[model samples]
Target: MLEIKNLSYRVENADIVNSVDLLVPDRSFMVITGPNGGGKTSLAKLVMGISTPTGGSIFWDGQDITALSVTQRARLGISYGFQQPPRFKGMKVRDLLEIAAGEHISHDKACSYLTKVGLCARDYIERDVDSSLSGGEVKRIEIATVLARRCKLMIFDEPEAGIDLWSFARLTETFQEIHDRKEASILIISHQERIIRLADEIVLLAGGKITAKGSVDEVYPQIVSDTVAGCNRLEVKGAC
Candidate 1:
């Protein structure tokens, strides 16, 4: 389980994340959704220790981990997939998978992970992870690495970004399989409706604060209503 207490962060005199508290139960999926620049990404970054909180505490299974580094957090079973995955200059796909899996995975096992992310193992396992791969391909490969790690807590920042329609559909099923088989705690920051529907709980953020958090039926309606109303207002002003 993960507990965030009074978490707050600021940058250049702008409060990006306010005093927000969230409790994520173990073995469940939590989806964070909001408009762009609403601080959903910042909250995820703070949890992953990519950015330090200006104030507050983060507890993992009852242990305080607010001051821990990103590597330390990873060692404690936390994994984060970035919005833009980094390129590996000379690393082969197979080598990266082996490192993530922490063992010599058989071609079959490696293929299974790659296939889940819409990649063919025979073609990709030997390829280099560099600028040669497309953004969508790199994103899928990073997700495969996360699956290989088998971490207790996995955070995906917009897994559907840069992927084709078909790949996005496949990615949703992969997440479902991970939740069902691994039973790991999954936190996804996404605006996709299909992805949001897969969540056990939906957390809504606006202006660096959680305006609503609850089960799908309890919270989704509010999001849809607010979004439609906002769009209508914008259209009336010729902004949309």
Candidate 2:
């Protein structure tokens, strides 16, 4: 299980994440959704060890890992995908997958991961993870690498970003498949309704705090209504 207690992060005396407590049980899927700039990404970074929290403790399976480095966290079967995935100019897609797995994976295994993200194996297997690939393609490829890692905890920061409608559908299916397997705990930061609906539990964060938390049936309606109202208000203000 992943446990966070009184987690807080501050910059220039502003709390980006404030006194957040969360628990992600094994083999479950959770979604964190909130308005833009609501600190969803920041919370994910803290969990991944990319950012240090000014207060509170992070525990994975009862071990205090708040001070562990990013690599140390990954070694503990934790994996994080960025909002904007980085590209390696000279790395082959296949090479990246094998490296993520920490051993040489076979062609079939690599293809399976790619297929999960709606990519054809032969088409992308030899391609460089560089400027040549579109943003969506690179995003999917990065997700494939995360799958290759087969981590105990998988955290994705907006996996649907830059993906096409068709690919987004495929991506959601992939998440469902992963959750169904009961192999790992999945935490996704997404505003997309499709992604949010897949979560076993949903958390609504705004202004660096969780304002709502519950199962999809309880939280989804509130989120949708609030989002629509907020957009309408924004439109009126913008028109004025």
Top candidate when judged by lDDT against the true structure: 2
RMSD of each: 2.8, 2.6
With a 3 Å backbone cut-off (N, CA, C), the pairs that clash in candidate 1 are: none
Model 2 over residues 1-240: C-alpha lDDT tens digits? 999999999999999999999999999899998888888999999999999999999999999999999999999999999999999999999999999999988999999999989998899999999999999999999999999999999999999999999888888998999899888999999989889888999998887888899999999888776655357322132443
Reference-based lDDT, residue 15, model 2: 91
lDDT of 1: 0.89
**Candidate 1 lDDT, tens digit per residue, 1-240?**
999999999889988999999999999999998877789889989999999999999999999999999989988999988888998989988888888888999988888889988887898999999999999999999988988888899999999999999889888998998788756999999989999999999998877888899999999888877766456321132455
The TM-score of predicted model 2 comes to 0.94
Total backbone clashes of candidate 2, pairs 3 or more residues apart or in separate chains: 0
Candidate number achieving the greatest TM-score relative to the actual structure = 2
Off by over 4 Å in 2: 228-240
Regions more than 4 Å wrong, model 1:
229-240
TM-score for each model? 0.93, 0.94
